[model samples]
Target chain A: MSRAYNFCAGPATLPEPVLQQAREEMLDWRGTGMSVMEMSHRGDEFVEIAETAEKDLRKLAGISDDYAVLFMQGGASSQFATIPLNLLGDKTSADYVNTGIWSKKAIAEAGRYAQVNVVASSEAEGFTSIPDQESWDASADAAYLHYTPNETIGGLEFDFVPETGSVPLVADMSSTLLSRPLDVSRFGLIYAGAQKNIGPSGLVVVIIHRDLLGKARKITPTMMNYQVFADNDSMFNTPATYSWYLAGLVFKWLKGQGGVEVMGEINRRKASKLYGFIDQNDFYANPISPRFRSWMNVPFTLADDALNNAFLEGANERGLLNLKGHRSVGGMRASIYNAMPEAGVDALIDYMTVFAKERG
Target chain B: MSRAYNFCAGPATLPEPVLQQAREEMLDWRGTGMSVMEMSHRGDEFVEIAETAEKDLRKLAGISDDYAVLFMQGGASSQFATIPLNLLGDKTSADYVNTGIWSKKAIAEAGRYAQVNVVASSEAEGFTSIPDQESWDASADAAYLHYTPNETIGGLEFDFVPETGSVPLVADMSSTLLSRPLDVSRFGLIYAGAQKNIGPSGLVVVIIHRDLLGKARKITPTMMNYQVFADNDSMFNTPATYSWYLAGLVFKWLKGQGGVEVMGEINRRKASKLYGFIDQNDFYANPISPRFRSWMNVPFTLADDALNNAFLEGANERGLLNLKGHRSVGGMRASIYNAMPEAGVDALIDYMTVFAKERG
Candidate 1:
């Protein structure tokens, strides 16, 4: 079957091989005579899938025994409330950096649970860049410091990890997980919505330090409590089994493509190719600063605004789809997540070049 | 594919046609050139899938426009906490009927958010039967009357809906939703985890009256708020898209099977055939009262305790899988959900009769 180069930001593109395998296994998974959707989460078949996926993810991220990786539901937007509900231990305040929409949402949710201290914010400059660590004024008594590693909407990303001193560092990595290798020990908790780089939309993956467990507030729902999830190994209730299985397939695919390190180099190359092309052409331009521009999500706009609709229409005709930016940010965004091939970026550049030449 | 009669409580058996169709559409849904898993929830393709699923579910359940249907995540267990968080508006207490494990769980979680008055409980008799509604002393000032219409683990079901006077009646139809037809107007709210009769494991369907909207507590998470979900058309966050899509397929298939009314007749026949066989044979017995016995989940115990493992092993050899009962209630359970064919039940009865004759 012919496939299009899809650039949806989250609930985004997945490897064609994974999709094909899922299709082949939809009726009967490996002679189990049941689809993964129909298998009990507690069943041996699904348990192995869940455990192997966890192990593969731990290996890919180089997560140690010191951290517990939780496969949860409700996505990262739910984690905005869940993080504070699980992590705040006697501390009434937490520090947050407002880099873009994601961080802003997290901060707002955390405020409902604790006192939110905005250590740094780039809202004044339209969230184009992550504020420098030296400019941050983190509270010494704060329970944790939260930030969005990559914001899908504005295409802003932090190039460096924040220094939180003794405070636990939390990150919403929804847009950039598994695109590169990173030290999992640097952050106390890392949560991601599994729609961008991961497999599907329903599941969220959370990696929390073992030390951070068992601190959930009394009001936290049983499903929202990370401590309860850790104790039960994320099976406090029936998990998003099929989504978790699909994520396992994605993890297996990533491992086959040579772990996160090799994927990181390829991702960097893809990002540079597209950004380099945009820089060389005056007709197209990216708004975010080069230092903070997201490698996974590239937001751009045509110099001639009137040609935008025609460009997207023509791109659709060429089998390039969902290049529209977030409605909150009116522009074009090509989310080149880990699953996206470098050839997709090359094709986008080729199509953009033709569209500009025809319209300019 | 060589299929087996799967008796797992949940994620339970699904229609073979649904699984086959899912496989066909796994790669390219209606020639969209993108898998349903990859589509953006906000994109037109997925939006239509979500809307159609909701509409089909509303039609199948005979839900009125006066009620809102919410497709949510985290399962029915999460709703145990979320129900009180969303509905305990201006009231300190709510009435709950504890029929079995599911009821106890919901009561425990709701206690974290409100004053739970368990007006009726069958736990003293080891949750073998549903308590009679006439024995229930529901509080007139209570926010809502909560009960599990069918308990999966204990195989207990309410023969009649409880009369709550002014209090809104809320039912957890998790184990039995869409297996039968009922008047939607009788209950203020009805919720079911999709793992049973609906579709998959991750998604939960909540049908709530229009009057119940905008009543969430201050501490309710944005993702957990009913009004937020209803107002946003259940897209308050990235929903369980694939699960929702599969549910739509199930709903479509149910409609093709002449809706819930036809399904209910077939289900009653399947249940009666199995129950009739068990009741007529002295070697097998079901403990629950006949009136309260769950039609979807038929839990039966062998007369001799020594033969339990041997019986399961023999059943497995005969292609009956996951028939072992929930550990909380040790016995054999055949979860003949809406998807379980009458032939599967016949096969199970055939296997059981042979086992009894061989070992008698």
Candidate 2:
């Protein structure tokens, strides 16, 4: 296969133009006579690259000067501990909504440092729906309210941001960021692992309001402390330079495609078409509530579990790949991110239509 | 210029062949129809790539089964904290040697967690030479004895591994790990940032004895805990896939060039010729004692400080890039790591000779 519609969730598909530019510049970046990876981070070339990347990211996301953007490493998992270590300064506990696996993981890591108040939980409902915000057990004394706007594995997404006035709202927007327009002021912090929608696996982008910068616990590792990065412009130590460069390419690609507003409309169409196909076909079904379905990742089950392998094998016979669902979830998931072309989603739906007819 | 001799300390030069292979496979890795960055980290293709890289690193470094090799994120700076967090279980103190800037940084970060005992320091001598081991005051109750085998900025290297009887030895070999053959059995843990001799930045390769695993403190982030990565084979979260792949290519390139013994001989010649030229020329001077001089990073000064920019500009025109030394130490540094060809060293020497003849 030359090039397939990759649905591996993450490290997921990247825009073809980004990959092409990266390949063209792999050995020599703009006549510098060195690959971006080979250039010193402190050098003029990489510094400009880093600065331009940050500037472009701020422009595309409508990030205000009130926020400090950090290009960090160790992915979103590291942020689980880092968030509490930094944010829970004088506070004893933090409020978290257990929407799915990602939210639960964040909650579990935060539990080690602070008393975690479960504001709302959909785990009891097999993570098929997001609990209503009105029913949430509000905590006035909590440092912040944390939630996953979109859960990749569970294929569940929140219809609206929770109302957490005065109390900061933090989100693990790993799978949802850059997919559409976002109000940056709505959250105290937004962290997204770059593999899905950004560029690559090793990098995680953190956009935190400046007020949340200081207050890291003394025990927090210097690299994990947000203030340290904020002070140094994310170069307190050597950052993931290549991953950061690739991410910059991705941000450029996003801007060229008319930024998030245009992406939001296209992504909506892609998700609705696939979800519509799954609903109309008797042989296929998605478990998530309609209002809570994710635009990025669409998970569905066939009429029989025995046909899963055959279904995947046939998909691979065509140019579709990594359609298998998460190991914990034993069905299929098609993650159509910003990079996943609408044609890819259409091809997937067409394949599903044929498969349901043949295997029904 | 198509390509130049990149003398950056790190994100340093990578072998031409490795970069070539990466460029060719950037669009689709082999027949997978997806870039390595696009593959699921748990997928068969990436897992194999990850495992093969580990296997090659182990074979090249002569690592035994007693060690767990981890491909981690956040570079060597993260390990400065991770080493103490994971190793300082019940022990109140750890022993350290202060060789140069890198060692001082490791010591500073470790101070956040434990009683850091500076066993010996060459700072009094301006980091020109390693302190003699016989004068060292190591602690019997120390959790571990740590040292930097090579100080990248100061251009200092240990001629011998510190002898710690029962105490496990830890080494930051970020600039010197695969430059030659190593006795992996000698250390409790060894870590090198991938930017230097490995592949790219944002990835750190850790080799640790199995006995060092399972001793992480309660406060240690799961990502920082050696045991978690050892258990999951470093895929607890998404690893740096693209960097790891490039590293595998570097390892393969090393093997093709006749393994570490051959590299050791070549690296020795590369360093010797550059150092020899500097010593013989009155216009150039390397400050470190000849015995303690680094084989990877050779920091030198000019006859006059005023001519520094002229020297650098001239070198740049000759397609010799990043020869400017660390800002803290205002001179010239030619970091001739394994990827830096002997020919690059020759070219640097040639450029220096012409500049010296004009100005001497």
Candidate 3:
């Protein structure tokens, strides 16, 4: 079967090799006589699978001993509520920097449990830029400061990490995670939805500093409480085992491709190639400031809105799928995650060039 | 490859045919040129898959138009929190019947969002029996009455539905769901984690009465709000597509096997045969009261505790695996869900009889 370059923002493109290996092992994983899906979470086989995944993920992210890595379910959207529920102990408030849709969502979920102080927001600037760190109005006794490093919809990214001093810094790194190297020590907590740059949709990776545990409210569900999950090894209940197994395969693939540092270089090159095309062409425009342009999701609009249909149609014909931008921000978006080969970006660029010539 | 009859309480056995089909379709589903995992949740192909799954699931459960069927993430564990958050709007309290581990968990999570009144409890009976529904002390002004129809851990089940009059009844049917037929109209809400009698662990099936909509607390996550899931057709976020798709396939398989009515008869016969073997011999015994013994999960123990390892080893030698009981209450458990063919039960019986003959 000829596979198309899937650009649809996640449940997105996975490495073909991972899919092939999954197919090969679908019936019998390591001759275990059962697919990973059928394994009990407590079984030795699955325990090893979960451990390997956490270990590989830790290695890839350069995580330190001070952090606990958790493989959770319900995606990053769940973390929006979970982070605040687990962290907002006795504290009635937290600081949140609203960079884009994701950060806004985190803030909204946090609002359920705590009083939210909008530290800074890029909405007034159409979410095309990240607010300067100096503009943030952090709360003195806030439980934590939350932010999204990359907004998948607005294609805005933070070029530098924010310093929270004594206050813990939390980030929803769903889009930018695994695309580059990260300084794990800088954040008190980091959570990412696995679909975009990691592995699958159901599993979420959360990296939390060890001290963040045991603060969850009495009412927090065992599954949602970070300490319960950490103590139970994220197997407090049955985990999304198949998704976790697939993520391990993806981690192995990342290791084979020379780890995250090498992946960062490749991602940088691919983003530069595609962004270079958009910047040079008057017919197409990515409004995000160059310094803060996202390396993962690149959202661009055509000079003429009428040409949008024609552009998407042509791209589809060339097997460039899922390029439609988020409905909230109408335009085009190509999410070039770690699994997206440079060739896919080159193909996208070639299509963009051809589409520009015809529409210009 | 030699296959073992996995008696895991959950993330349990699937029909061999379903596993084979999933394996065959792993790389490309119906020549769609993409793995179902790779398909965008909003794409036409995945939408069709999702719709068909919902339709087939509705048919299998005999769900009517008055109840909205929602596919959600976070297993039954999440629903423990979401249910109270949604149903207990202005109400300060709800009635819960603690039947086993799952019900206790549900009660604990609900307590976070509302005042949970334990109307009945089987824990004092060692969780081996379900309290008579007539003896329950349900509050008149409580928002709803909650119970677990079948507890996976203790293998206790309610044989009769409780009478709640105009009060809504919510059942977490995770283990026994679709193993038998039920009058759907009798309950206000029913939810099942898909790992047991359904398909996979990541996806949950929530059936809520139409009248229950719009009652969620303001802070409920959009993904957790049943109304939002109902309104968006469970596409409020990117769902666990592969799990959802597999569940649909299982629903179709169940339909092919003469639907829930016929399947229920088969399940009853299978449970009776296995339970009969254990009861007839003093060496093997199931502690659950006959009426409350779960048809889905049958937890039993040997007359000798020291023989546990030998029993499991001998069982594994004969291709019966995961027979060891849950660590919480150890001995042995044989979860014979709808997917476990009668032959598998016979095999387990034969193995047990042989082991008893040798040990006795």
Query: lDDT of candidate 3?
Result: 0.88
- The sequence of per-residue lDDT tens digits that candidate 3 reaches over residues A213-261 is 9998866766788998888998888889889999999999999999999
Summing lDDT over every window of 10 consecutive residues in candidate 2 chain B, give the lowest-scoring window.
B123-132
- At residue B143, candidate 2 shows an lDDT of 98
In the range B1-360, model 3's lDDT, one tens digit per residue, is 566788888898898788888888876778766788888888899999999988998888889999999988888888988999899978899999998888888887888888999999978888878777778898999999999888888889899999999889999988888999999999999999999888988888999999999998886766788898889998877788889989988988898999999999999999999999999999988889898888998988999999999999998778788999999999999999998899999999998898899997
Task: Arrange candidates by DockQ, descending.
Answer: 2, 1, 3
Most accurate candidate by DockQ? 2
lDDT at residue B210 of model 1 (Cα atoms): 88
Candidate 1 residue runs with Cα over 4 Å from true position: none
Quantify all predictions' global Cα lDDT against the true fold. Answer: 0.90, 0.94, 0.88
Residue-level error in angstroms, candidate 1, position B124: 1.9
lDDT by residue for model 2 over A1-360, one digit each (tens)?
689999889999999999999999999999999999998999989999999999999999999999999999999999999999999989999999998899889999999999999999998999999989899997999999999999999999998988999999999999989899999999999999999999999999999999998999989999999999999999999999999999999999999999999999999999999999999889999999999999999999999999999999999988899999999988999999999999999999889989988888
How high a TM-score does candidate 1 get? 0.99
For model 3 chain B, where is the 10-residue window of minimal lDDT?
A: B26-35
Ranking by lDDT: 2, 1, 3
Q: List model 1 lDDT by residue over A1-360, tens digit each.
A: 368899999889899989989988888888877888889889899999999999999999899999999999999999999988888889899999998888888988898989999999999999987777888898999999998989888888889988887999999888878999998899999999998888888899999999999999999999998888988989989999999999999999999999999999999999999999999999999988899889999999999778879988998988899998889888899999988898999999999988888887
Alpha-carbon shift of residue B105 in model 3 (angstroms)? 2.5
lDDT of 3 at A27: 71
Clashes of each: 0, 0, 0
For model 2, the superposed segments whose C-alpha errors exceed 4 Å read: none
Binned by DockQ into CAPRI classes (incorrect, acceptable, medium, high), candidate 2 is: high
